[model samples]
Target: MSVLVYTENWDGKFKKLSFELVSYAGKLAEMLGTTVTAVSIGSVDQAELQKLGNYGAQKILHVTGPNLDKLDNQVFSSMIVQAASKEDASVVLLSNNNSGKAIAPRISVKLNAGLVSAVIKLPVSLNPFTVVKKVFSGKAFTNVVIKTDTRVLTLSQNSFELIETGNKATIENFNPEIDTGLFKTSVKDVEKVTGKILLTDAEIVVSGGRGMKSPDNWGPIEELADILGAATACSRPVSDEGWRPHGEHTGQTGKIIAPDLYIACGISGAIQHLAGISSSKYIVAINTDKDAPIFEAADYGIVGDALKVLPELIEAVKEVKSS
Candidate 1:
């Protein structure tokens, strides 16, 4: 019995979530007294794939095929199902992002295995593997046990600490024959979002709200985020008002993030927004209104204008970087 992790990549480079999943699956491997193997489809730089060994992956399987380059959810899921069936993986792990959400469910149906989403912790026992996951949109946690023959789990981003080791593993190229003609959808083009850090995998996030005054005033937020090497996020109203793209919106109806440090500026904490980011390890709220609901959930609060506070924070970060 072994743990198999599906590694997602972009443009021959690996995504940060890959290391996180590898690290997490390594822990599960230890619990089950088995080894961890990573399966990656498409063409990726060999150097990037070999780096998985640093996170405790004993073997990295690279499936090279021209058709695998483009993401067809069914194709990817079928590849994973094939690998899982051949290896008899006791547990298969995937990151709960756009890809995993689509692939895991289909794989579950194909393998007839129990599936868990947004899993935050590892299983407690092997007799009947049980995992802990978040539910009610981060409001609470639940313990679920899998009684099926196999288990498939999708972990939430930023839920586990990525472990690194100096060990390097051997990479093997796998040639699987798949009938590409059966693929239902084809990827036309990947419109990449420009950013040094991805919001889902970022350790720190600085988000703004409508209190930003106007779209033009957003320069300070970007400057501060750049200085801190953090990703920028916006509130629902800001996205609705066209101040930022809907992709950057963070709330109940938006993308959920769980960074190590979350800084909320000029936003009154709405229950919906909190539901999305409440899993952050530490939260800091900055606003002029002292009684704003954001302060209630913040680990630290500053009663000041965002315009004034952001620049100071940027300067402080610059000084720290310079030192």
Candidate 2:
């Protein structure tokens, strides 16, 4: 039995998320007494492909072709299924991000594999392929046992450690025979949000809510984020009210992020918001409302107006850095 991990790339480069998945797959492969095969779908450079070997991929499959750069859900899923079949991979792992969420179910159906998503840990038992993942909106975890011979798992972001190994992986150019008719979609226009830290990839996040009063008050939030090199986020209401961009929204209906440190200023922690950020290692809540729900989830709490508190917080951070 071999392990297959899908290493997603951006602009022909691998991100920390890919390394994290490889690390998880590599450790799992070790536990199962097997090797790991890393699969790359798009145009990734040889140098970038070699990096997966440092994370314990014994073999790397680089699949690139015409129209493959643009994501066609059906084609992408098909490619993974084919790779797993060729590699005889018993376990498949991918990030529980947008692509994984969309394609994992399809891969499961094609492989007839049991799928467990949002998995935070390695398997509990290799016999039945039991895995653990957060359920009930990250409030609790459940151990799911995959009864099938093959299993597909989606690892939560920032859930695992990136471990480098000495293994130098052999890279193979994989070109699968596919009917061009499957390319039902064409590239229209591509727009990217540039010059800002991506929320999902940020280790620290500074978020604010309507209590900042208006969009004008967001300068302090941005200043603090810049000082700490953190990503700026906001509660749903703040985004909906146009105080912040919708892309910065974090909650049940928005982006789910697990940062090392999450600071919520002027935000009341509704369960919806907590559902997105509850996995943070440390939470700091600053709100004037003593009974704000955010306090319950915070590792540290400060009861004060956010507008007054942010400046002091920024200054403290600067002083600490200077010291």
Q: Cα deviation of 62 in candidate 2 (Å)?
A: 0.8
The local distance difference test score of each candidate is 0.87, 0.93
lDDT (C-alpha) at residue 263 in model 1? 94
Superposed on all Cα atoms, the candidates' RMSDs to the truth, in angstroms, are 1.5, 1.1
lDDT of 2 at 77: 88
Model 2 segments more than 4 A misplaced: none
lDDT of 1 at 132: 89
Model 2 Cα lDDT, one tens digit per residue, 83-184: 999999999999999888988989999999999998999999988789998887888889999999999999999999999997799999998767778777
What's model 2's TM-score? 0.97
The top-ranked prediction according to TM-score is 2
The count of backbone overlaps in candidate 1 is 0
- Put down candidate 1 lDDT per residue, 1-323, tens digits, no spaces: 78999999887787778899999999899888898889999888877888899998988888987676777887888888888876679888999999999899998888899999889877766676788887788788888999898889999988888899766877888765578686888667778777667788788999999788899988988888787889999999999999998988998899899999999999998999998899999999999999999999899999999989988888888998999
Clash counts for all predictions? 0, 0
